[model samples]
Target: MLAPVDDVVAWGESLDHLLECKTGQLVFENFLRTEYSEENLLFWLASEDYKKITSESEMKAVAKRIYAEFVEVDAPRQINIDCVTRGEISKNLSQPGPNCFDRAQRLIYGLMENDCYPRFLKSDIYQALLEQQ
Candidate 1:
């Protein structure tokens, strides 16, 4: 279903390229949705947004929101991460900062790149898009 011409180009290039392009990222997000793994992309996007927050109050607010939604145990969209990383995030949450989620963010990024991205490339949706091109 990801038929945007510009995005199609990057989709066929590589996962790294696709992740870097907004259009391609959306397509990938949709693909992840079909697999019930949209949280991976959502976590990555939230991290990017978190880095852009300049206000202290805003940064703490977004940090807590992201942690509660994606990093905390039993979180609605909790991402799979090691206990150490999760523990670090939990400790940081007590004094939430702009960089509190950095470790967890990196772990999620790697999970997507190494796990989901490969499956996405081989998915029927991706193949269909290639055929269309």
Candidate 2:
């Protein structure tokens, strides 16, 4: 059963606010999975982790791994970014930096905010969580 409309609205306020909370992010990710868009969140999370690497070699390795896993053509989790962003990332590969994926990350973030976020707010799972509370 779903929660009261007011309850769900009160809990989330907005998708951006919801995403700021750990539980909300988990719920949002689960919702993304239903639409086969989970990679958006996964890539965002990976980029966050990638930015934390302190060692130059480690940063380069992690950046390469992220590209292979998420940015490369035909990557298992290839995100829906434009060629220009992809080209920028490819260029950055020569001298990997923590900011290498920043442009792509922002694009993905916008995608989620404009596309998936509204759907998640309406998903049964999100309402169910509110009902439980």
Per-model TM-score, in order, reads: 0.89, 0.87
Best by TM-score: 1
Pairs clashing in candidate 2? none
* Cand. 1 TM to true fold: 0.89
Name the lDDT of candidate 1. Answer: 0.85
Off by over 4 Å in 2: 1-11
lDDT of each: 0.85, 0.84
Candidate 2 lDDT (Cα, whole model)? 0.84
lDDT of 2 by residue, 5-44 (tens): 5545654677566655566667678789999999998899
